[model samples]
Target: MIDKKTYNEIGVHIPSILLPKEGIDMQKWSVVACDQYTSEPEYWEEVEKKVGDNPSTLHLIFPEIYLEHGNADERIKRINNEMKRYINEGILVSQKPCMLLVDRSTPHTKSRKGLILAVDLEKYDYSAGSQTLIRATEGTVIERLPPRVKIRENAILELPHVMLLIDDPDKTVIEPLAGKLDSFEKVYDFELMMNGGHIRGYRIDDGETLKGILKAIEALADPEVFKSKYKVGDDKGVLLFAVGDGNHSLASAKVHWENVKKSLSEAEVEDHPARFALVEVVNVHDDGIVFEPIHRVLFNIEPESVLNALQDFFGSSCCSLEKFDSLESVNKRLSELKREEAVHSFGFVTDRSFGVFTVQNLKHNLEVATLQGFLDYYLGKQKEAKVDYIHGEDVVTKLGSKPGNIGFYLPSMEKHDLFKTVILDGVLPRKTFSMGEAEEKRFYLECRKIVKD
Candidate 1:
């Protein structure tokens, strides 16, 4: 067990990770994050066929795609039952208290490395302008939490796809651990399903090694170090960790913890399982990590009217629209803008035509911020209009080309600016950037009990 002193020092707890017993098909057992493939039900259907009664994380998670399909209450009931059965039937066995060193490889990215550990929720604050050591990189949508809270509130086990980022530009924290992995025991090594690339985990159980990791993380959180790195004033709060992905999931955990803590005694609050959430923390400077933009696709809207509304809102002086004959020309223009160092320009594709919209004067720093603001207002006025945040240019072309559909492709934000921007300007707009494509997301492999026996 992790003592209070150690937990306080590192803002992490070594969890008793639950893994499937031997002879289980690890390939079928792991699945991508629940939040991914929300627009495509067929992806989940394919996953169902592959798992086929085998013990899998698919049974434990309620995919968002199915959230609106009805029977949500029944689905959550089945999830909780599966968790209990997994424990009772010895399908999942707990290991010694340790951190899991993860190595992930995908087709589009280099081998990304991370350490899976439980972070103290107390150190994290998702509210705007929070001064905590852990902060959200993007704004948290409270309305999106009820469905997630329902799934997590009564669950016996928690499997996290939440990825946290630490800005250790000098590579002090997670990088050094990779060198000493020879001493750690191997956990699970297998290829993930759904074209999600390979993954391997090692257990770090040595007390001294765990302490070393904590010390490194603490150094990154040091006030002077943070100030020097970001060139900020002494009054600025040190942001040691940032939410890289799954901001909503982490927020839900926080909300549930708040509700749970209210009913617990002071003693229970000290080491309550609900007080910490399991996450894989990765270094921001890791070469394997790539920041991709989450583009916007609008459905059931008059494309011409939407374009005119954008011009009306921003005015002709600030907003200019240039039409293109095909997707190639639009992409070519966007590629040129990248070399020209132009910002606040977005490419749009529709059934009628393709074009690029350039805004000379902007209220927000990122193009997505400016575009999303207008969309929120426009969609509010048009009750029939709907928008989905999507990844991949190909998806935008395919879906946005359908009649009455339009997609706006926004450029990605620089990885280096993420920490400093959040520290100075508060949280960014939601759905700002994706860490990688959907397939590259963290798959559920490890589990921990959140409810006390």
Candidate 2:
């Protein structure tokens, strides 16, 4: 048996990872994360056409776009049924007690290295001002979590798209393994559908390497080392793992684990599969880890009403708005802003026009937080308005320019700022950053049985 103490100390576990058996078409079986391309139904439609009637991850996961179409209970029911069918029919087979070393090459970058891991939820906390081993980099939208929590509560096998990030400046953990990949067993290699990317998986099942990886990760969490690295006081919590890609997904897993623990004995809880969430852990220093701004588009609200509300909510005296003839002008203006000039600047688009809003004397470390503060306050006052975090400038612009809609194009934070920022600041405003564009997001390829026998 593997030492649970070693795993617990490092907040990591070796999963009996699952994949489709031989003779199955791996291409159709893999799908991009459900959260991507929310406004583009045509993207999912194309995916459906490619995966028709096959035993695919598409069958097990419910895409968010389908949630608004109504009969969500029916969709959830169908999803549960498909999971059981796949498991019982032997579609997903496991290579016992292993971690997957992944080499993913997307169109945007050459290669991103990741290790598939099962992280202990007990060490994770998403609440504001967390000091746990695992922390959230951005604020989580609690209202956006219920539907996801419901899906996970009944999920049999979890196909992970969530990614955890480590700030290893010395390249201690993942970088050293890249040169030695040939010694490992190659498991899966294929191109992702819909121009997503190409991925190759290799198995890491030996006890020697697993022990070394655990030790390296544990060293990163050393309180003294962490304090010196970030120049933080000893009173702060150690933040070894930060949710990089799927913030809410890990939050949902933590929620479901909390709920599950209530019904179990303390001993039973220790060994349950649901206590750990499957994730891909990548080094923040990875060459392919591009930090992109997650844009926002609010629907069913008058664009003028939103601007008026923003002006009123932040107080008319503190901020100023400048109008532009087109989005190009707004972009050019925002790019021209000096570091000292902009407390923060947001470029916006509406059905009528495009402009940039500059706010000074900020209340938060990030502009997203300042904007989200106003949005939450504004949405509470009106029942008809709703917001969605969008990927890509074109999608946000197109959606924002539609009638009765508005989109705010936020700026991307520096990639190097992530670990230190989250260290000193509790968490940034929700929907603060995205790992890459929608097409470059992690695709679902491997599965681990989340249900205990």
lDDT of 1 at 52: 99
TM-score of each: 0.97, 0.96
Off by over 4 Å in 2: 1-3
Estimate, for each residue in 103-131, the C-alpha lDDT of model 2 and write its tens digit: 99998999999999899999999999898
Global fold similarity of model 1 (TM-score):
0.97
CA shift at 374, candidate 2, in angstroms? 1.6
- What lDDT is obtained when candidate 2 is compared to the true structure? 0.89
